[model samples]
Target: MTQNKLEKYARLLVKTGINIQKGQTLVINSPIETAEFARMIAEHAYDVGAREVVMRWSDELSTKMKYLHADDEVFDEFPDWAKEFSLSYSRKGAAFLSISASDPELMKDVDPNRMARQQKVASSALKEYRERMMSNKNTWCIASVPTAAWAKKVFPDVSEDEAVERLWDAIFKAIRVDKENPVAAWEEHKRNLKNSMEFLNNHNLKSLQFRNDLGTDLEVELPEGYLFVGGSEFTPKDSEFPETEFIANMPTEEVFSMPKKTGVNGIVYSSKPLNYRGTLIDQFSLTFKNGEVVDYSAEIGYESLKSLIETDEGSRYLGEVALVPYDSPISKSGVLFYNTLYDENASCHLAIGKAYPVCIKGGENMTSEELEQHGVNESITHVDFMFGTKDLQITGVTHDGEEIVIFKDGNFAY
Candidate 1:
C-alpha cells in the first residue's frame, strides 16, 4: 500500500472506528504483519491529541504453535498480570483498536480440546475487560487486514501478490476506504444501521422462524424487553467517555439483539464455513432443543465443534440473534472472505455464549446475577456463523399468534 493511502486509512480508523476523544489513550492490538499500519495509526493517534498509543503484537505462527504444543494443564493457568494489563486500561477510560488477519485455516492441525480449554481460561481471566467491551464502556473497534494465506483462501487462482492486492481491494471497498470521504461515508452507514435497529425494535416480535431447502428450521424467541441495536452508543450516564456514539466494527451491517436463553429450537445448518479460534468447521449441521445443541455433525473439524460446545454449559445455547440481508454488499461480492469479521456481515447469524447486555433494554444496568435471572446466556465465548442465503426465509411470530414475513428470500420483507 502507498504511504498516502496508508495515512488516509489510518485517519479514517482513528476518526471513525474508535472515535478517539482528546487525551484518551488508544491501545492497538495488532499482528506483526500489520506493524507498519500500526505505526501509521499511532502517529495519527498522537496527531489527533491522543494521550498514548500502546501497540501490542500478536503473531499468528506463535499463537498457532501455542495451541500445537501446549498441554491440557497449561489451559487452566492464566496470568493475573495479563488480566490486570487490560483491565487497567478500562479503568483509565481508554480506547481499543484490534486488527485481525489470521489465516482462515491456521488452526487446522491443532488440538481443538486444548484450544477450547485455553479459551475458557482466557475468558475467565479477562471477564472484566470483556464485559466492558460488550457494554460499550470502552471505545473499541475491530478492523481487518488481509494476509497472503487469507488472500489465497479467497482467490486461489491468483499469485500471492495479486491475491493480496485483490483481497485488499475487496476489504478497502467493503470498509469504505475507497469512498471519496471515508469518515463521512461511515457516519451515514452508522445512521442507516441505527435506523434499521430502530425499525426492528419497534416491530414487537415475539419469535423468529427461519427456513430454507438447505435444511434450516429454527426459531429464536426474543426476550420480552429486548432492544435491537446497531453501531455503538456511549451513554453519559454510563461512562466517562460518553461524548460520542462509536461504531464497534468498521464495516458493521447487522442489526442484532439477544435471544432468550431457553427459547431457541430446531436445526440450522451453516451456509458458510465457520473459523473458530483458527480452526474451520464446514458442512456442519446443528440440532437444538430448548436452546441447547443436542446434536451436531460436521464433515470437517467435528471434534473442534464438540470442544466448542463443551467449553461450558452456556456454550450449548445462543447469546445473540442478528439479521442481515442476503443481498448485502459483502455477499454480492460472490467471494467468501473466510474471515468472520467480513463473512458474518454477509448473512444473518447467531452467536453462541455471553450475550451483550446492551442488546437488551435496561440490560447495561443489570448485575451479572440479574442478567442471569433474566435468562441471559453466559459463557467463556461468543461465536458467530453465517446461515442466511438468497433462498432463506424468516417469519416473525407476534405475541398474538399471527405470523409476518420479516425476511423473504434474503431481503427484509418489512
Candidate 2:
C-alpha cells in the first residue's frame, strides 16, 4: 500500500474509529507484525494531543509455540498481574484500539482444548474489564490490517506480496479509507446504518423467524426492552467518558441486539467457515431448543467447535443476533476472509456467550443478577458465526402478533 493511503487509514482510525480526545491516554493491543501501522496510529494520536500511548504487542507465532510445548497446568491459570494490567488502564479511562490480523490457521495443528482452557481462565480473570467494554464504559475500537499468512489464506493463488496488496485494497474499500475524506464518508455510512437501527427499534419486534434453503429454520426472541445498535456507540451518560461517542468496530455493517437467554429454538446452519483462535470450523449446523444448543456438528474442526460450546453453561445459549445483507460490500467482494471481523459483517450472524449489557434499556447500570432477570445471558466468551445466504428470509413478529417482513431475500425489506 502507498504511504499516503496508510497515513490516511491511520488517521481515520485515530480520529473516527476511537475518536480520541485531547489529553486522553490510548492503549493499543496489536500484533507485532503490524508495528509500523500501529506506530502510525500512535503518531496520529499524539498529533491530536494524546497524553500517552501505551503499546501491548502480541506475537501469534510465539503463542502457538507456547501452546504446543507449555505444561497442561499452565493453561489452567491466569496471572493476577495480567489482570491488573487491563483493569488499571481501563479504570483510568483509557481509549483502547485493538488490531485483529492473526493467521487464520496458525493453531490448526495444536490441540483446541488447551487454547480453550486458557481462554476460559483469562476471560474469568478479566471479567470486569470485559464488562466495561461491553457496557460501553470505555472507548474501544477493533480494526484489521493485512498480515502475510492472512493475506495468503484469503488469496491462495497469488504471491505473498500480491496477496497483501489485494487485501489492503479490500480493507481500504470496506472501511471507506479509499475515499478522499474517510471521516466524512464514515459519517454518511453511520447515517445509513442508523436508518436500519431506527426501523428495527420502531417495530417493537418480539421475535424474528429465519428461514433459508440451507435447512435453517430458527426463531429468536428479543427481550422486552431490547434495543438495536449499529455503526457508532456511545459511552453511557453516567460513564467516566459520559456520552462520548465512538465506533466500536471499523468496517461494521450489522445492526445487533441481544437475544433472550431461553427464547430461541430450531436449527441454523453456517454460511461460512469460522476461524476460532486460528482454527477453522466449517460446515457446522447447530440445533437449539429453548436457547441452548442441543446438538451441533461440524465437517471440519469439530473438536474446536466442541471446546467452544462446552466452555461454560452460558456458551450453549445465544447472546447476540445481528442482521447483515448478503449484498454488503464485504460479502460482494467474494472473499472468504476466514476472519469473523470481516465475515460477520458480510452476513447475518449470532454470538454465543456474554451479551452486551448496553443492548437492553437501562442495561449499562444493571447488576449482573438484574441483567439475568431481564433475560440477558452472561458468560466468559463471545464468539460470532455467520449464517446468512442470498435466499434467506426473515419475518418479525410484533408484540400484538403482527407479522412484518424485516428481511426478504437476505436484504432489509423497508
Candidate 3:
C-alpha cells in the first residue's frame, strides 16, 4: 500500500471508525509485530489533534511462556498499578484500539482453565475498572495485525510476506477500504443492519430458535423492547463521544440479541472451535436448561471448558447469544480466521463470560449485585464460540406460540 493509502487507513480509523474528537486520549492495545502500524496510528491521532496516544504492546510468545511457568501464586496476585490504571482510564474519556492478528494458536500449550481463572481473579481486583468500562461507557474499536502465525494459518503453502499481503487484502475488503468511499459504504451498511434490527423489534418476538443437522434445538427468550445492536461504534472511555465503527457487521449474516438471562434452553453444537486463553476446544457441544449450561462435551479441551462453566454461577448462563449465517464475509472468503475479532464475526456464536449491560433491559444502570440477581452472567472473560452451520434453521416464537423464521441454511431469513 502507498503511504497515502496507509494514511487513509489510519484516517479512517480516526475520522470514520473511532471518529476521535480533539483532545481525546487514545489507548491502543497492539502487538509488537504491529508496532509499525501502531506508530502510524500515533501519527494519525496527533494529526487529528488527539490529546495523547497511549500504546501498549503484548508479546504473545512471552505471555505464553509466563503461563507455562508461572506459579499458582502469580495467578492470584494482580498488580495494584494495573487495577489503578484500569480505573483511571475508565474515569476519563478515552478511545481504545485493539490490534489482534496474533497467533491464536500461540497459547495452545498453556492451560486454558488456569488462564481463564487467572483473568477472572485479576479483574476482580479491578472491580471499579470493570464497572467504569461498562457503566461509564467508552469508545473503542478492534482491528487486527497480521502476524506470522495468523499468516501461516491462512496460507500454509505461502511465505510469510505473501500471507501478510493476502491477510491485508482481506482486512481491507472486510473493512470496505476497497470501496470508492469507504466511510459512505460503512454508513450505508450500518443503515441496512439497523433496518434489520427495527424489523426484529417490530416483530416483538419472544424467543428465537436454531435448527441444523447437528441437532441444534435452542430457544433464546427476548425481554420486551430488547434492541438488536449491530454495526455501530461505542465509546471506550467516559468522555469520548460515540461513532459508528465498521458497522459492527461481521462477515456473518445473523442478527442477534441477548436472551433473557433465565430463558435459554436446549442443546447447541459449536460448529466452530473455541480458542480460549490459549486453548482450543474443538467439536464442542453444550446443553442448556433454564439458562444454565447443564451438559457439555468437546473433542479437545474438555477439561478447560469444564473449568469455564464452573467459574461462577452466571458462567453457565450466557451473556450474549449471536447468530451469524455461514454467508459472512469472512466465511465467504473461506478463511478460518484464527483471531476472534474476525472469527466471532464470521459465525453464529455465544459468549459465556460477562454480559453486556446493554443486552438487558435497564441493565446499564443496574448494580452488579442486582444484575447477578437477574441471572446476568458476570466475569472478566467473554469468550465466543460458533454454533451456526449450513443446515441450521432458526425460528422465533412468541409466548402465544407465534413463530417467525429468523435463519435458514446459515443465512438470515426475513
Candidate 4:
C-alpha cells in the first residue's frame, strides 16, 4: 500500500475509531510486526493534540517461545508491575487503540494448558482494567493492519508480497478506508446499524431461537433490560469523558447483547474457524444446557477448545449473543481472516465467558451482585465463535408471546 493510503487508514483510526479528544492520553497496544503502522497511528494521534502517547509492543513469536520454554510456574503468575501498567493508564483516562494482526496458528504446537494457565492468571490480575473497558469507562478501539504471516495464512496460494497486498486491500475495503471519505462512510454505516439496533430494542424480545441445516437447534434467552448495541458506543456518565463516543471494533457489523446466564439450551455448530490466542479451533459444536456448555467436540484443536471452556467457573456459560448477516461486506469478500476481530464481524456469533456490563440497562453502575441478579455472566475470559451461515434462521419471542422472524436465511427480516 502507498504511504498516503496507510496514513489515511491511521488517521481514520485516530479521528473515528477512538475519537481521540484533545489533551487526552492515548495508549496503543500493537504487534511488533506492524511497527510502521503502529508508529503511523501514534503520529496521527499526536497530530490530533493528544497529551501523550504510550506504545506497548508485543511479538507473537516471542510469546510462543515463552509458552514453550518458560517454567511451568511462570504461567501461573502475573507480575504486579504489569497489572499496574494497565491500571495506571486506564485510571488516568487513557484512550486505547489495539492493532490486531497475529499469525493464526503460531501457538498450535504449544501446550494449551500452559496458555490457559497464563490466561487465567492475567485475567484475574487485570480484572479491573477489563471491567473498565467492557463498561466503556475508557474509550478504546481494536483495528488491524496486515502482517506478513497473517497475510500468508489468509492467502497461502499467492506470493508473500502479493498476499500482504491482497490482505491490505481487503482490510481497507472492509473498514471503508478505501472510500473517498472514510469517516463519512463510517457515519453512514453507523446510521445503517442504528436501524437494526432500534428494531431489536423496540421489540421486548424474551428469547431467540436459532436453527440451520448445519444441525444447530438452539434457544437463547435474553436477560431482562438487555440492550442491543452496535455502531458507536458512549462512555459511561461516570467515565473520564462522559460524552466520548468511540467504535470498539473497526469493520464491525454485528448488533450484540448479553444472554441470560442460565437460559441457553440445545446445540449449535461452528460455521467458521476460531483463532484463539494464536491457535485455530475449527469444526466444533457446543451443547448448552441452562446457558452452560455441557458438551463440546471439535475436529481440530480440541485441546485448545477444551482449555478455553475450562478456563474458569464462568467459562462454561454463554455471555454474549451477536448477529451478523451473511451478506455483509466482510462476508462478501469471501476471505476468511481467521482472526476473531474480523471473522466475528462476518458471522452471527456467541461468546463463551464474561458478558459486557454495558449491554444491560444501567449496568455500568451496577454492583457485581446486582449484575448477577440481572443474569449477567461474569468470567475472566470472553471468546466469540462464528455460527452464522446462509441457511440459518432466527425467530424472536416477544414478551407478549408473539413469534417474530428476526433473521431469515442469514439476513435480517423486515
Q: Candidate 2 residues 223-334, lDDT tens each? A: 9999999999998776666788899999899999999999999999999999999999999999999999999999998999999999999999999999999889999999
Would you list the C-alpha lDDT of every candidate in the order shown? 0.86, 0.94, 0.73, 0.94
Q: What CA root-mean-square deviation does each model show from the true structure?
A: 1.4, 0.7, 2.5, 0.7
Single out the weakest 10-residue window by summed lDDT for candidate 4: 234-243
The local lDDT score (0 to 100) that residue 388 gets in candidate 2 is 96
What's the lDDT for residue 51 in model 3? 92
Against the true structure, candidate 4 has what lDDT?
0.94
Instruction: In candidate 2, list every pair of residues with a backbone clash.
Output: none
Q: Native-vs-model 2 lDDT? A: 0.94
Q: RMSD to the native, candidate 1?
A: 1.4
> Model 3 segments beyond 4 Å from truth?
1-4, 233-254, 372-375
lDDT tens digits by residue: candidate 3, 172-221 = 77777777787787778778777877777777688888778888888887
The sequence of per-residue lDDT tens digits that candidate 1 reaches over residues 147-166 is 88889988999899999889
Question: How big is the positional error of residue 3 in model 3, measured in Å on the Cα after superposition?
Answer: 4.0
Candidate 3 vs candidate 4: which has greater TM-score? 4
Model 2 compared with the native: what TM-score? 0.99
